[model samples]
Target chain A: MMDYKYIEQLLERYWQCETTLEEEQILRSFFHQGDVPEHLRQYNDIFNYESEAKSEHLSEDFKQKMIDLVEEDTAVEAKTITLSQRFAPLMKAAAIVAMALTIGNVAERAMRENSASEVAGAPVIADTYTRTEDVKATIKVIDQNQSAIMAKADSVKTMDLIDEQPEIIE
Target chain B: MKEISFKNDILPLGDLLFRLALRIVGGNRPEAEDIVQDTLIRLWENKEQLADINNIQSYAMTICRNLALDHKEKFENQNISLCETDHDRADDHDSPDKALIKKQQYETAEQIINQLPEKQRTLVQLRDIEGKNYQEMADITGLTLADVKVTLFRARQTLKEKLSRLAQ
Candidate 1:
């Protein structure tokens, strides 16, 4: 008993592309309610299909996959680093430590020989004090050199860590 | 300017883009899925440039459409025709015969729309299904408003003629 004249008019305009978006929506809504009169039943499929098509969507798994892909791309490094390249700074630090130990041991031996000679030659107090000062100066210079080498090694290690943080986070 | 978060802003457009891609690539789900994935990845990679864009959804649609067209061209042999059955659930109150008829009608409707050319089908998907305005369709499709109307008119006309015959 409902008048479908308005719907028929909208359908005509819809085919002509004269209906506004809202009017088109009204037509869709009308067909979606079902129970179309015999004359309107044929148009039912078109609106129903459009309505059903709107439900077509990518799954949540697909969404998660896409997010993982984007994150992976951002996490990966463009320039690949080999194992040797990664540990090169560590190798340099180890070498510096070994050289410093050797130098320290040699300096200790030289100081031991000098003190032994001084003791045997009836060393004067002033001369003994000067020899002690020279040994102290040599040890201090060695310590400063060692500290500088360790500082440089530490900075290089820090930089390497910074560069590798992205991979680590991934 | 509002900041664009990939999860919130870009990723939500996935379903919309997927639907568009599906229509463009002739209902090949895998191909359509690939197109959407590529489109999202491209958008995320170039998200820095997206901050200035007025409508990111429309912009994403454009990118998605172009990628779909390229993918279709590259694999011309595999652009299988759309024959997917509608997944729409039958109304619980409907009788079995009515349900089957409704299902067939929906399938026929899909077949009719799928028969349209790529441009016309895409325009139909955007306007009728996606409920996009003419201006938005023009912006997404790179067509003038008048051209959008004309193309949509032609597409709808074809649908009308075919549907009328179907009713008869």
Candidate 2:
């Protein structure tokens, strides 16, 4: 049998929480050998519980259950993922097509509006000053600015034509 | 840092974490089993968070404890009685050492140990049973080192007094 004196002293220290981990291990190992005299037998259960409590585990099917549950969880999540993934490319392509059509329509309308504005402005300029005397009279009033007036009108019409094209496309 | 292999690193912690969940729920095996499953799944979902953790075992232990406690709280709210699952699980896998034990003593031993406060019981289980050091215990239980020592001290004291009384 082991020395009762040392074991008693160790048990006292253990209650006080003064024993180091090694001393506690020694106490556990000592009791584990089942060599205790009468006085120390009471402490056996406490030590034994420490070792035996570990065996209170889940069943063998636990790991497999977890694996199945995890797989199922991921399966549910994958559906939303595939839905989003499936839409992603189609949405992107649609956006690209929509954007291209918008630009093409705007450009086509702009070119048409630009040509129409030029045609209208050419006729208006021609209609504005038919005679040189009328031109001189308007020039005197407008300070020899017939050509300048036509130039300003042409530039303003061009800008207005460019601005209106996108509106017409929509 | 090396990559944490799920099979090698994470799965290996299951038994330890299971022991912890079992400890927290006072040996309720099924609930403990659920908590372990939830912890594993949660950890897997948030595996990205693992790379930042210094001690994976401690982190896993914390998750198990918290989830077990949450289950414990729900059970209390529902006023459900803790069943014989604790006894059944342990008895399901009786060891040779256990056979040497008197039936009443083995039964009373775990029940008495389980009766301690959650923190104290877990500390004792992790330290004495699992052979974890004080630092790891502190990390796993989210207690300061001094608090771990104090809780463990009280736990041991409680076990000694109760076991002596039971021995009669």
Q: Pick the candidate with the highest DockQ.
A: 1
DockQ of each: 0.62, 0.48
Local distance difference test, candidate 1:
0.87
Candidate 1 residue lDDT tens string, A9-110: 999999999999899888888889877899888788899888878888888999999888878887883878899999999999999999999999999999
User: Which candidate tops TM-score?
Assistant: 1
**Clash-forming residue pairs, model 1:** none
Show pairs that collide, candidate 2: none
Candidate 2 segments exceeding 4 Å error: A75-170, B1-5, B77-83, B86-101
Candidate 1, B1-168: lDDT as tens digits? 677777998999999999999888878888899999999989988888999998999999999999999999999896555655345466456798888887787778878998899889999999999999999999999999999999999999999989889777
Assess each prediction's global lDDT (C-alpha) against the native.
0.87, 0.77
Residues B1-168 of candidate 2: C-alpha lDDT, one tens digit per residue: 566555566777888888888778876667777788889888888777898988888899888898888988988665344445434434444675664444456677778878899899899889888988888998888899999999998998888888788778
